[model samples]
Target chain A: MIPDDRKYTQEHEWVQVEGDAGVVGVTDHAASELGDIVYVDLPDVGAEFSAGDSVGSIESVKAVADLYIPVSGEIIEINEALDGDPALVNNSPMDDGWMFKVRLADPGELETLLDAAGYEDLLGK
Target chain B: MSDLKQTPLHQWHIDHGARMVEFAGFAMPVQYEGVLAEHATVRDAVGLFDITHMGEVFVEGPGAGAWLSGLITNSIIKGEPGKVTYTAMCNEQGGTLDDMLIYRLTEERWLVVMNASNHDKIVDWMQRHLPAEGVTMDDASDRTGLIAVQGPDSQDLVGRLEALAPHVAPIAELGFYTHIAVDGPGGEWIVSRTGYTGEHGYEIYLPAGAMLAAWEELLARGEDLGVRPIGLAARDTLRFEACYCLYGHELSEDWTPLEAGIGWAVKLKKKAGFIGRDALAAQKEAGIPRTLIGLEVEGGPIAREGCPVLAGDREVGHVTSGTFAPTLQKKLALALVEKDFAEADLMVEVRGKRLATRHRALPFLAARVKGDPRAERALS
Candidate 1:
């Protein structure tokens, strides 16, 4: 299910705004499409990236996909738990699977992202 | 999707919620549950696979054995009836055309099973080389269906078939690489004690029309036995772990059987000289230039197929197949590299970054295909 609290990208990533920071992770549809993620290459905390820059990668049993940053920000935290158990992405894509927390460069960028209804339309759900 | 071919069990796969993908021109199931879970099911318990896309060719007549012996790298004439010999067919240059299994039903009858992608090519090659007399070849691919039941509990799941018990040996008594043919109401069924997976398994070849019933029956009977439906994704991982050479990946026209690490299947001294015997002999005398070796990459990034293998900035070779081995819990890759750098310090270039890798043995995991039944029980 597409969560209403988070804004999503066409690349299948979602970001939930919390104060000045945004928690990012792939959507459930992306996790299911990936098919049993075995490894997640998380970006380093404090790493800076521009919008649409590849932050890291998600490696599944069959293939791999790059995780793109939706907006310019500096990484403040990464989920270290994924290093030991990446299947969490498939098990809890909307909650415990949060990949990284970024200090948002422009909160206004959140408005440009697709809301639940918009994302559902994009996915033709 | 309309252009792709479908197996007789295609609807069953769809009804069971399998994710389908295009493979070898056929619309096949890539996974049912998930690759990791399906892979684990095969390694730990049992799994069924609909491999109906694979090709089956029948050769009959008095000269069948001799004709086949001259075509394959391995000696088919030397193998007794009921035995399945794995061999490679090659061109005059010793480049592999396809790797397949030849089942000798009798002195004058043989059955060849080959890769689905190479079906047309292999059949064309065989037809061109058909002898003027004493041998007849028939391609039965479209009319045949294949089902593979693999894993530790495979024997128990397959042995429970009362229909098979009346026709063939008790599944437990069937020797490795052996098969028994039965004339059933549907058609002739050939149950072979052979499989691509390293686990104990069996491959049943029957009429295409009868596949759906068998598949449904197996699932119905295997529900309590922890048997799950496997797919192409897990099939690759399973065969990769077993160090089996996938045609396009490991065995190809670009790499000979010797360099591909299937030299055991290539018998240069067989009584009948094959198409590429001279070339393979010459290559062996000159020393193999490159060798297929297993590698374990450090870190999360996988060195996938086509990734360059470098030895201190010099390109050595490329990865043929790589994945996060579900059973070993490590990132592993099979690379075709210069024989000199096979054991040397190497790095695989993945996504513009070089990752350190260590040379590992051919199979990342020990194959338990033929061993004490107790050993399988111990693992389970």
Candidate 2:
């Protein structure tokens, strides 16, 4: 829900950069709509990706949704903890529930995304 | 699109964060807190369900007593004033008209609860049997709202409410399949000591006007005490775990009780004939062609309805009800197969993958009763 501290994709994914690495995950609103997060699919570590591409998919108990990458980059690491506990996405989508980390392909491309305030407005919040 | 029905609690469910979905021709809450959590909570503590969409029919008058006896498969007149009997309305051929519960309130009066989708069909069927100017059939579904409180602690939870205090009686005295008329918050109602979930619980049949207050009362007291508002998702899983047969799943226009494993409800010995009595009796003598059985699957990852039941390479049957049985922690399914193959060793094809499964006697989750057969078969 912290719209200002992070950048958002049109797909409702949020990306927060820490130094040179970008942490990617879904927003709280997305998880709330999906209900229980029974399964999470993440890209393999060291997988190369470009901007505006689907990274993987997420499956709730009732429905399935594809996860799109907000900022194009190489997936440097995946959150292994979610393999056992998918509810973390529902409980704490921002902190311990981050889905993956990526090294930015072009840091300048980040400017194309919406800042926290803009994302909030896009959500009518 | 506007024809689907909505219960009195429909708006309340939406207001309380319930995800609504269309089911059985009624818009019902599919889940509120999530299916797994609600399912677990009901098994451990308590959960409340709005089951107002279920149909209710009142049979009364001169031969209203024995007329229903001839129509239904259970002994409706023999029960105590408050006692309830889970029975089926079957055709002469034993094909199920509808599986229902008969609440015997008096010698000449009884209330039958039926499935929502089959309400009209059951009513039409009952009218066909109405004695010549002697009995009357009244559809009370429009005026009633039923709420069920289920789980290990449900009895204690429901008994604690000030509004429900008058209905409270000795816990042991209220046996299974019984009901009573108490000074409930909404007025006189046939509060039946019955529930679809295999736990010890009560189903309150009260006036629709009092539904909101009664719901708020249960939910208010149930807050944070592990009593949750369950939805259709939890309802299906809970009933499936209890091996309770659903209307469209186990019994349908084409299927019969002998095949559905509910032959005990048919009173063939009564010497009176029902719609399908002769057909059922013939099936009994000739042996059923197919039998419904429970399958406990390993590594199938929650078998669901329509998963094919495979006998080696042949597709013999398919699952009618299936889920990752919350209590058993294993994928369980109910399926109809040839009578000979409905045995211990069986396999099911789920998602084009053949998986090994075992035929376990139904009611996978044991209701904590003194001499429950499920208790003895519990996988410890």
Candidate 3:
């Protein structure tokens, strides 16, 4: 359920470029693969991190997945809605599941991620 | 995975859009309409399960009843012909070798159905222990297929099957933990009022090769009655809610029935010199180091197996089986904990975070079966 406008990470996180920084969330592929999302521990606001670093955790009915930071930056805001109904991540992975806002720590790292076409090839979609 | 086994109804399951997964070395179906939904169907309406993965063994001879009585923890000879019994065969250490159903087809014949993973183990154990020359323990699992139709409407759905109509008239009349040979689409079969879902259901055993034909006939006819093909995922959750023990989780070589809260299965009054008799009796008197307990988490994220169970500030146990009870809408966890922490309202640590967990009485979601005389039967 990933949109063509979004950038992709091999780790299954998706990023949609919103003006300057990016809106980040786990891919629908990830959520469906995890089955049911029961809990999502979000990263704290103003939390700075580097690319490929661990950001948070996404738990499902049977398993738990480590959410990775695709772009090195600070988490500007967390998805507070997920605290109440984590299922939102499963219902709207690209939209409501948008986990946090990252104030781009290194915009240059964005180039290292796959574009919509490249990512599609990786998934063989 | 080359040698992985498949149930007789494997192709039928695939045709119905089942997602298959490898479980206990068998390529088994794990879901059809999603675990939660299928689980609910079984709890509310009726759900059909391809339980061919369960191993079926038949033992016969004049010495059958007496020989089996010495092997299992429950009374095998007490059940009349065409009746069933739930019992556990334990190791010398009082650990469960297999929890199985003993079906008495006749005075001299019996059928033992066990977990697919423990089929070889149980057979080997029988071969090693029950060494009577006249008795025969035949592995009928490969030649037999089991189908469980469970829930409230199961009786109505299964009773109408043309092949079963003659012998299974008024299916609800058959007491729980009882069975009789009946005609099926493919051949004559055995139908028992046995289910793991804690519901009023029936378990039908038929010739293995004809399971596809039988499953198709049942599915096609039961569709209008809300019968759906369920899978292992739903099976696990349903049983967990009912507090049924999975072999690997609630039982293992290192765990004993006394410690697992199933000490009631151990027979201390018998002089049959059964395996694990002494060890279980001693444990029953002196008590065990650890005990199995049930926990209900207040919030989200079902506590799963291997998650550390923290009692206050200490890691006192590990969860054995945990899942979201779709019927109760609660996260449940069954833990094997130190006897010291087996009290009510024991807290649990899920993924490094502590949650207020209630250690309530198990069978987290109890089902109410309509009045059946089988209620008086000690099938527990």
TM-score of chain B of each: 0.97, 0.93, 0.93
Where in model 3 is the C-alpha error above 4 Å? Answer: B185-187, B370-380
Give candidate 2 regions above 4 Å deviation.
Answer: A2-30, A39-83, A86-89, A92-125, B1-4, B161-164, B170-172, B221-225, B344-346, B369-380
Candidate 1 TM-score to native? 0.97
User: How well does candidate 2 score on lDDT at residue A55?
Assistant: 71
Runs of candidate 1 with Cα error greater than 4 angstroms are B168-170, B373-380
Q: Which has the higher TM-score value, candidate number 2 or candidate number 3?
A: 3
Model 3, B234-327: lDDT tens digits are: 8888888778888889888787877777777667787676788888888878868898888888765668888888766788888999877777
Q: Of the candidates shown, which would achieve the greatest DockQ relative to the real structure?
A: 1
Model 1 lDDT tens row, B44-153: 88899999999999999998888888999987787788889999999999999999999999889999999999999999999999999999999999999999999888
Task: Record all residue pairs in model 1 with backbone atoms less than 3 Å apart, i.e. clashing.
Answer: none
lDDT per residue as tens, model 1, A42-92 = 998889998799989999988989999987899999999998999999999
TM-score to native of every candidate shown: 0.97, 0.82, 0.93
- DockQ by candidate, in order: 0.87, 0.21, 0.47
lDDT of each: 0.90, 0.79, 0.81
* lDDT (10s digit) by residue, model 2, range B211-318: 888888887887767788999888887888888888888888788887887877877776566667788878888888898888877642445677888887777888
By lDDT, the candidates rank as 1, 3, 2
Q: Rate residue B154 of model 3 by lDDT.
A: 84
Alpha-carbon DockQ of candidate 2 = 0.21
